[model samples]
Target: MRIAMIAAMAKNRVIGRDNKMPWHLPEDLRHFKAMTLSKPIVMGRKTFESIGRPLPGRHNIVISRNSQLSIEGVTCVTTFDEAMTMAGDCDELVVIGGGQLYQQLLPKADVLYLTLIDLDVDGDTVFPEWDDGSWQLQNSVTATNDKGLQYSFNTLFKKC
Candidate 1:
């Protein structure tokens, strides 16, 4: 399975501040839905909680060490291994994150879909720094969201 990360980070790489996304861009959300619909999406417990409910039309897999806790409409897996196993022969796995998840999965990912927002905000959750030696930019398309927020949709492929 091909692992990819889909995120929108600020100029300073801030992903979230308090268990929530820092910005609301309708076009970006539309892009997210278009890319992730019907695919298996892997994310951390906090990211799942922040979303509040399982997104319709996709398999939501939440990675956590706690096996006892469970959320309806979503599969709760205790480890990355188990998550991978549950995903089976999925053509792609989208690592939709909450900091730690990004750090843990970025190394294994083959493609990255990053929405580069042009704002910097204070936040505890930040995207992992990309290593210039390991990944190379493939495509970048700049567009304005429905809210008129400017963002760039960038894709990166890992260097072999």
Candidate 2:
């Protein structure tokens, strides 16, 4: 199965603060939903909690070590490998994040779907840094929201 990651990060690579995204970009959210629907999504427990619920039309696999933790409409696992095993037979799985999960899975990803926000906001959480030389940019679409937040949707494929 193909493994991909989907995330929106600021110019400083900040992805979240206080367990929530620091920006309000509805267009980016819509794009994320459109791209991830009907696919299996693997994320850390914190990421799942930040979202507050299972995303519709997709298998929600949350990685956590808390064995007793259970939530309706979500599957909890102790490791990233377990999450992948649970995803079983899928054509593609999207690694939706909370920093550590992104870092851990970056090496295995075949593609990355990123929304590069123009603002450089302060945040405690960040996306993991990777060498740009390892991935080839496939496409990009620049857009501006009603609030004047500028961003670009970019797709990159890992070089062979």
Candidate 3:
């Protein structure tokens, strides 16, 4: 199964703050839906809670350390291994995250779908840095949202 990490980060690599995204870009939302449709998404419990519900048309797998935690309409796991086992033989599994999930899964990702935002925004959470030399850019397109925020939708493939 292919493992992909999808996120939008600001110029300063801020992906989130206080359990939420620091900025909203409609175009980026569209891009996220398109890329993740039909795939099983694995995220931390906080990430799942932040979204508030199961995303339609896809399976949601959440990892949390809380043993008593359970939510209807989604499978909840206590560890990453359980999440992987639940993911099974899917064509692709996307890690849609809050910072902690990204940090844990970065090394295992086979591809990255990133929305590179142009502005530097304040946030408590940041995306982890990676070595650029190990990945090859597969596709990229820059577009400006109605809010006039310039961003690029980029897909990068991890080198074998």
Candidate 4:
């Protein structure tokens, strides 16, 4: 299966603050839903909790160290490896994030779907730093939100 990492980060790489996204971008949320719908999405426990429920129309796979934890409409796995294994015959597995999951899966990801928000906000969680040399930009589309926030949807492929 192909592994992909999807996230929206600010100019400073901040992804979340206080267990929630620091900014509200409905366009990005719509983009996320459209891209991930019907795909198997794997995320860490914190990411799942932040979302509060299983994302409809996609297979929800949550990775956590807690073996005994269970949630309706979600599959719980102990490790990233196990989560991938459980994804089965899916052509792509999108790794949704909380930070640590992004850090752990970056090296294994074949593609990155990143939304670059044009702002620097204070946050405790950050997207892991990655080498631009390792990824080739495939496409980008710039957009502006209703609140005047500018962002770009970027697709990058791991360079061969």
- Which structure among the candidates has the greatest lDDT? 4
**lDDT tens digits, residues 54-98, model 4?**
999999999998999999999999998888888988999999897
Q: Candidate 4, overall lDDT?
A: 0.95
lDDT of 1 at 153: 88
Task: Tell me which residue pairs clash in candidate 3.
Answer: none
Q: In model 1, what is the error at residue 67, expressed in angstroms?
A: 1.2
Model 3 residue runs over 4 Å out of place are: none
The sequence of per-residue lDDT tens digits that candidate 2 reaches over residues 47-125 is 9988999999999999988988898999898987888899999899999997998998999999999999999999999
Candidate 1: where is the Cα deviation over 4 Å?
146-148
lDDT of 2 at 118: 99
TM-scores, all candidates, are 0.95, 0.97, 0.96, 0.98
CA displacement after TM-score superposition, residue 138 of candidate 1 (Å): 1.6
Residues 1-160 of candidate 3: C-alpha lDDT, one tens digit per residue: 8899999999999998888998878888988999989889999888888899999888899999887888999989988778889988889999999799899889999999999999999999998998899899999999887878899999999999
The positional error of residue 42 in candidate 2, measured at the CA in angstroms, is 0.7
lDDT by residue for model 1 (1-160), tens: 8889999899999999899888887777888998899999989999998998999998999998898978998889988788888888889989899799999888889999999998888888999998878988999999876666778988998989
Which residues of candidate 2, in runs, are more than 4 Å off?
none
Q: Give the candidate order by descending TM-score.
A: 4, 2, 3, 1
Q: Backbone collision count in every prediction?
A: 0, 0, 0, 0
Q: Over all chains combined, what TM-score does candidate 1 have?
A: 0.95
